[model samples]
Target: MTTICVDAMGGDERPEVVLEGIAAALAADPELEVLVAGDEGVVGPFAESHERARALVTTEVIGMGEHPAEAVRAKRDSSIVRGCAAVRAGEADGFFSAGSTGAIFTAATLGVGRIRGIRRPALATALPGLDGHRTIALDLGANADARPEMLVQFAHMGRAYAKVVLGVEDARVGLLSNGTEDAKGSELAVSYHEALAAAGCGFAGNAEGTDLLLGSFDVIVCDGFTGNVALKSMEGTAKYLVKQIKAAAGESKRSAVGALLFKPALKRVAAELSGDEYGGAVLLGLKAPVFIGHGATSATAVAKGTAACAAAVRGGLVDGIAQALADAS
Candidate 1:
């Protein structure tokens, strides 16, 4: 059985949303077990009622704005730290949190530790692709600055993740650049492009920002600074478009009627573009599977995110990445 340690006190909402999501996740997977880490007074009762759920009482909680490394060290008994410690202790196969991204990354790196030979860990998310397949993008916000060698490692790691978690065979990888030509982008992009091509890991050359949703490549690698900017921009644009569509739909009686007629299609489109549908971002290059969800994540998103983490563990994601890196070396 695969067990995942969950941070019951993490996220904007407290133990309530976390417990409800855990119940939903447990109901969905019969063989799964959960270890809830938070204050015993809150999470203990809820965990007791569930069959396969257990609670590990933690006294402290990590604030979202705290310095990641400092908080991890100072608050050793914090929910985030304890949850990661569970994985390191072999009590859980993975860890899931909708808490501070920086804190979680720090805890995971220090507690469960990084895979041998990995310079840094990356946060990868599945983006909706035009080809009916999800494209994997990495270094979402793990490191604001990265070297060309790190980007090359990101490509290999992203390829392994796509194959294992997304079930894509021979995933194509591309360097995210200003243009498709090798001459475009900064010096880092140029160096990465040449290195990846020589590495021969299904290099698809360079891809522009427009290619992200076009499914032109199965995996795209870039420095965290560029990747994070692109991610937030797309998210903001999606929200703006949705709002505009809703407003237009209610502009007039005739439009309302038209919207009613196409409500089903519109709902489908909304789900397709929703962040919850894809769960949360996966933290790659760790010793175990770890997923970080949005801070304001809903109960449904939590359930889906936990399920995604479980799937990653079952799919041998860590082993796959280790093997890929070994082969590349």
Candidate 2:
């Protein structure tokens, strides 16, 4: 059975949405168990109603604006800290939070700890892909800068995630660059490109910004600053395009009729592009599974994130990445 510890006090909606999400997840999976960590005043009653969940009271709460590491250290009884401690102590298989991204990352790295050979943990997210496959991109704001060796490590980490969680055979890894040429981008990208090419891990050379949503590669690697910018750009662009499509469809009676006819197709496309279905970002290279959902995530998104964390734990994601690193060594 896979047991996950959740920081119930995290996120904008607090225990209400978290409890609703936990209820939904428990209803969906009979084998899953959850340890809800938060103030006993809130989480205790909710846990009592659920058969598969139990509450672990935490006295302190970490605010979003506080310094991540300092807040984690000072507020040892915070939900986020307690949840991570649960994983470290072997009381849970994974940890999930819709908390401060930096705080969650810091707690997971310092509390649950990193895998044996991981230099820095990378934040990876699944992008919509063709043929029902999701492309996994990494270093999404975990580290602002990355060395060539670190980029190589990110490739291996991403490839393992793609293979184990995404079920992609022979996952193609791409380095994000300005152009799909050998001699583009900064010295960092140039050196990283050469290193990835010689690393013999299905390197697909450089991928420009346009190739991100095209499903051109199974995994895309880049520095955190660049990757985060690209991610936000794609998100904003997707939203803009969706709005344009809706406006265009409603502009004319004929267009409205056509849209009604194609409503199902449009719904499918919207679902595919929706960030809620992606279940939040996974913090790879950690000793145990750690998922960081958006602060404004809905109950459905929280439920999906919980399920994703359980799947990663069941899939032996950490072991797969460890073995991949061992092989490369």
Candidate 3:
């Protein structure tokens, strides 16, 4: 069984809701082993409720609201640090956290280290696009600003992730830009356009924000600042669409009844579009699989995130990414 270490104290909901989600996930998959790293006092009781919760999961509490770097260094009991340590020590295959992203990123870098030749890691989030496939945007807050070479490296990492995680073979990659023309974006885009093209990463030229969800490419590459904005925009748009649909249905009794009749189908569609369904973002360019769950992620999200991490580890995504980067270099 692949062991996944979860930082139980990281999210806003902490041990309670996160525990509830873990219960739900374990109930769904009995064979999965989870290590809940958080306050044992809080997590212990919660684990006793389920038959296999205690048997399958072990609790190791870490302090909350502490400086991640200092905490990781000083507090050997801290959850995030211990969780990463477990993975590094071969006790677990992956680490999932909904806590402090900065701390989690920092801990992963310091404790787990990056793959060979990977300068810095990038956060890759999947966004729903045209057809059935998702478009992945990299550097989604990993590096605030990236050099032209870094952006080029992100493109390679993004392409490999799409192929392994999303099962896309010839992943199309586009540089985020203001216009479709090659000269549309910043000097970075202009500088890296030929680099991406020269690297032969199935380059799809420049893509605009308007075309982001229109399925312009399988992967989109940009610095974290722009990528984070684009990701938040997509998430906000999805939420607004759902709210609008709910409002439209409640406007009339007839519509309400219609919605009730199609509630299950609508819910299924909504769940698929929900950001949590994709199980947060993966910090690519690392030596081991690392998933950054949303701070407000539901138990379903945690469960799904665990599954995603397991798949990534089993697929050797880390080594594959390292090899891709080496080939690009």
Candidate 2 vs 3: which has more TM-score: 2
How many Å off is the CA of 105 in candidate 2?
0.6
lDDT of 3 at 162: 89
Candidate 2 weakest lDDT stretch, 10 residues? 267-276
Candidate 2: residue pairs that collide:
none
- What does candidate 2's lDDT look like per residue over 1-329, in tens digits? 88999888888875789889988998999999999999988789988888989998999988878899899889989999889999999999999898899999998999899999899999999888667767788889999998888899999999999987878878999899999998998888999999999897789889988777775799999999998999988878877887888899999999999988988987777666665687789999999999998888678878988999999999889999999999899
Which stretches of candidate 2 lie above 4 Å from their native place? Answer: 246-268
- Model 3 segments more than 4 A misplaced: 27-31, 45-76
TM-score of 3: 0.87
Summing lDDT over every window of 10 consecutive residues in candidate 3, give the lowest-scoring window: 54-63
- Model 1 local distance difference test score: 0.88
List, residue by residue over 1-329, the lDDT tens digit for candidate 3: 66777777777765677777677767777666677777767667766766545322334433346666776666566677777878888877888888777778878987778888888899987877667768888888878888777877888888888888888877899988888897777777688676777777778899888766675688988889888888788778878988898999989999999988988998777777666788788898877888988877788888888778878887888878887877766
Per-candidate TM-scores read: 0.96, 0.93, 0.87
Report, for every candidate in turn, its global Cα lDDT versus the true structure.
Answer: 0.88, 0.88, 0.78
TM-score quality measure for candidate 1: 0.96
Model 1, stretches more than 4 Å misplaced?
Answer: 260-264
Q: Rank the candidates by TM-score, best first.
A: 1, 2, 3
